[model samples]
Target: MKATILVAEDDRNLRRVLRAMLVREGYDVAEAPDGEAASAWLAERRADALITDIRMPKMDGLALFRHVRERHPDVPVIFITAYGTIGDAVEAIRSGAFDYISKPFDEAELLRVVGNAVRTSAVSVREGAGGEETGGWFGMVGCSPAWREIRKVIEKAAASPLSVMIMGETGTGKELVARAIHGISRRGKGPFIKINGAAIPPALWEAEVFGYEKGAFTGAVTSKPGRFELADEGTFFLDEIGDVPLSMQAKLLRVLQDRAFERVGGVKTLTADVRFICASNRDLRKETGKGRFREDLYYRVNGIPVHLPSLRARREDILPLADYFLARSCAEMGIAGRKLSRETAEILERYPWPGNIRELENAVGRAVALSEGEEITPPDLCIALADTEEEEATPEEMRFHESVRDHKRAIILRAIRKSGGSKTKAAEMLGLQPTYLSRLIRILKVEG
Candidate 1:
């Protein structure tokens, strides 16, 4: 069946053109002269996607977008705007519009955005009512006691409109918890904008968060909405919050307190009704005490504190998470599903995953790619299982030096095998000099 597209524009000629363009692409086209008529049409029927002009008679695209968000959350809305109103269109994107195109727009760009919207809408419908699968609890996959407690906190946090702070080690899924909070909240249908403090430079921090006018900087050719503005009536995730510069913390705090900020170079004050979800590997309280982070900002953003335990702490979740990753990897790689051998499963459960869930997922993906048999073995995982045994051994049962040598040998052998027995490639994989690897290979008596 052809996907249906609804075009809402006040200009009769432009609406007709849009209809023709959509029809040419083999899509069923519906036309509305203005937002009011579009809303009326939607009250009785459904369209796979919506395309509307930012400015329309009787009602505007923003109003229509809000209505669609509330009534038909699955349908993606695309905005058409003049160059002068690009900021408005960008704001709509922050408020959950799928995409936008400027006037004098290329027909190809419009069709491309429309095609994406239609496909995304169809996928959302197929996924279920909430438009996303929540795995077990809002897309988190775990049944451990720690996870159950975290779920309670997430449910309570989502019920309120307060800011959230998720604290965890680097790969313990802090961002996943932040997303779960947003997905289950009242702002679930709204945009979930995120920024990594560590990734953005200190020089561009202000403009990146608060936006700027076209002439604000050397490369600023056009006005752009910041993450906060885009996140209006939604959730804004601040990843690696501890990495935010001290100079910017006060500005962030002010926004959180007053919900108002001006563009970097412009004086017009903009306010966003956003719920902030912050995550950090560092403890903000310690940073505040060390004067590296502002105490006031810490207090403001840390309205609710939730901590995710490292994978090792929640050992029972390891096998389950590995299996989940295995199935997902198989599907993504377009390969037949494979199961973990009994020894491999035991090794995975016993391994202390220092890098946590993210590392485990990578390992599973690698195993899926490398495993040629119906079952993944310990060797296919490319992990030093000897280290796990060494850690579990009592001092009386095994000599520390012997265990260390064995662990090193196991790791070197695995790397060599994974590199197709090339010492140069194995050295690169092990982050060792080729001469060093050769020396170790001789000392450890590891032979192909």
Candidate 2:
């Protein structure tokens, strides 16, 4: 089947040039004078790929790219921009544009990029038709046996009404797994409320979890519903469950056991048909032994424990995950047609992702941002796998002496400085929830 390519360029001559080139290459070509028209065309017809200019009349390339990503994940995109910068190219790739070409680009180069994009689009369609679930079940993507086994367990767990405990290293996608189970369960239509257990400070734990009555405490101007109440007949994902305070754990336990909870200052008791799914990077057993985590709560949440595999443990899945991340990152950034070079793939597969999936995702995003060309390289990733080759370089004693708190302080300060005092940007750089970063900043006493 001939691939259909949509060309959106305000420049009439360039649009003709692109359309002519693609049509001559045996592709069914569609042209729109601007992004708005292109987006309209996209709404009706299925285009294998999109070729758009960075600048357009009503809508720009970035905006169009976002539209395509949200509506058409299967169609690959190629961007053509005269004002291309390293930053622009990086942004394009990170946004999920299939590829970017500078103005006055060689016809050969354009053809090559388009060919690749078309091929990718075809592959996506084929996979979707083959029932591969490229987006995976509920946006989780993995093909490894480990992942399959985990999915089977999640499937079984989803069938029941039992509480589930997810165990994994930070960034191993524990919440994603929880969501997958929720999405497949009987309560799929219900709200999936996620709360970071650590983000809620000690004083606000009750107000946040159980909510408060009007004028219950200082600044409690109105009655508010808690996460549990909001997640009625849904799934409540308590992330970083290990960080939940011992006192709060008992309250959570009561809700789990009785399926009933009371507002902070309300006399009336509320009932919720909510499912509990807890996740923790820390070993709850160790926390229980240390008298940090409640034993009863631990036993209750661990009704059907599911473990997520780290990237290093599932090495065979690294490349696939990398590709998925790359695609997602680019799509989100409104850039498309970016690809990993063979060498980059090797670097990613060989690196032991200590930070696991989260780390790998950050690495891929960094690579896409840093890489200038169509292909991402090792240097583009900017990942220093020191432990990979020099595991013994740092002495255990020296490592042990390093203060984690001090190290974290330094890192936070660096991110703050680099982002020019923007907490939002710093949070993005650190891959942290902005609220969580704000809490850390206050707790760590970071100066503005």
Candidate 3:
């Protein structure tokens, strides 16, 4: 794709000349008369490169550059100033400015300066500080193949402002995925607002997500900005989206479809110009088939369904992730870094991480807090694991007579839970048939 550039200058003639010259060179160019306009422009769309004059009314290039750096520090910036203000340009250079081109310079020189600045900026972005290759977002902190695939999908999804649904068991870092996508997307400069769709009551869902005008409903004392409005020009993350009532799902679908919504008791339609990223632990497809969720809405939200692999599927990453969190936990406590003994690492690998990555982080955190030494041993982790018996299960102890019955019964139970109590889904989750599942459930005396 051709590079898109933005020119921020107060002079109208300069803006016109720059636009004409850049367009002739086959570059997409946007013009802003001042930093205020430039900020608004950036808030709407992302640019490959930004060129601004240092001084302006309302807001200056330094302030705009600072904001851009804070939001998207990777975006290249070029500042133009007269020779007299070269000192200010020098300051900009120290603050991560792309490059500075003195005023009254040739058009060719300016073009080369901007082009080179953009190229260099992209290179530095990929090779982050300390000359290390940047992988995914900062919080992901895993080099596992499973994590790598998750990162690749998030990067691709962030390019567009489409809605994304991430489904995983609880404590799988669903929110981290949402934040990573938003942080890398064009809307990185916009606000990022998150809300849990499960905790709020059905009566408050509308007011919470779509806001409300004064006196819209009882206890609606004044106007309030909802999560959708607050996230305009940015990303809105809805956690536990499957928990939303079927009635509210229709409203969500309308806003997603039209990119617009209206506050309660308000006639005029307001636009929700933002990216929607929803996550849930429930099987939304099964929910729709069972008449508990809207079919259309399910299709809408699951446009790009990303299923995060459970921790057990990628057991190779357990030890490395545990060590990473162990170091972090020690630093947080102002204690010496803790090393996980090889024995401890082996134990961690054997325990099925039913709670996934979140559980691992917590396990390490608790170990660090409870242990007083620099080395975390197997005893430390074992004590931590024993506190939670959610993974408790017995071996296939039923000999000859009951062995067949016990194994089949366990499979049936797992499938039913995974399928949200639907016979068809249970069959699908376990790779069985509806008839087989029905027979097993009857024989096993399964309870819904």
Predicted model with the maximum lDDT? 1
Candidate 3 lDDT over 1-448, as tens digits, reads 4668999999889888888888988889998888889988987666778999888878898998888876555577788878677668656653446556666756765766566555545433322121111233546666688888988898888886578999887767777788778878998777676666665667667876887786686545445456687777788888788888888888999999997898988888899678899988889899888998899998888878788888887888888778777877787568888898887888789888777776787678767755657788654554235323324344543342254355455555655676687777666444344786677678657665
Candidate 1 ranges with C-alpha deviation above 4 Å: 1-136, 384-448
Worst 10 contiguous positions by lDDT, candidate 1: 125-134
Order candidates by lDDT, high to low. 1, 2, 3
Task: Look at candidate 2 and tell me the lDDT of residue 167.
Answer: 89
Q: Report the error of model 2 at residue 364, Å.
A: 1.4
Model with the higher TM-score, candidate 1 or 2: 1
Show model 2 residue runs off by greater than 4 Å: 1-134, 383-448
TM-scores across all candidates? 0.65, 0.60, 0.57
Query: What is candidate 3's TM-score against the reference?
Result: 0.57
Clashing pairs in 3: none
Question: Model 2, range 172-194, lDDT digits (tens) per residue?
Answer: 77766887888789998777766
- Please write out the lDDT profile of model 1 over residues 1-448, one tens digit for every residue: 5788999999999988999889999999999989999999988667999999988889899999988876676688889989878878786777667777777776765776687677667644432123223255554578789878888998999998888999887777776677788888989988887666775668778877888786786645556677788898889988788888888998999999999999878989999999999988898899999999998898898899998888888888888888888887798578998999998898798788877876787678767766678998876674322244445667765775575566567777777898898888787555455887788888779876
Q: How far is 103's C-alpha from truth in model 2 (Å)?
A: 52
* Candidate 3, residue 334: how far the Cα is off, in Å: 0.9
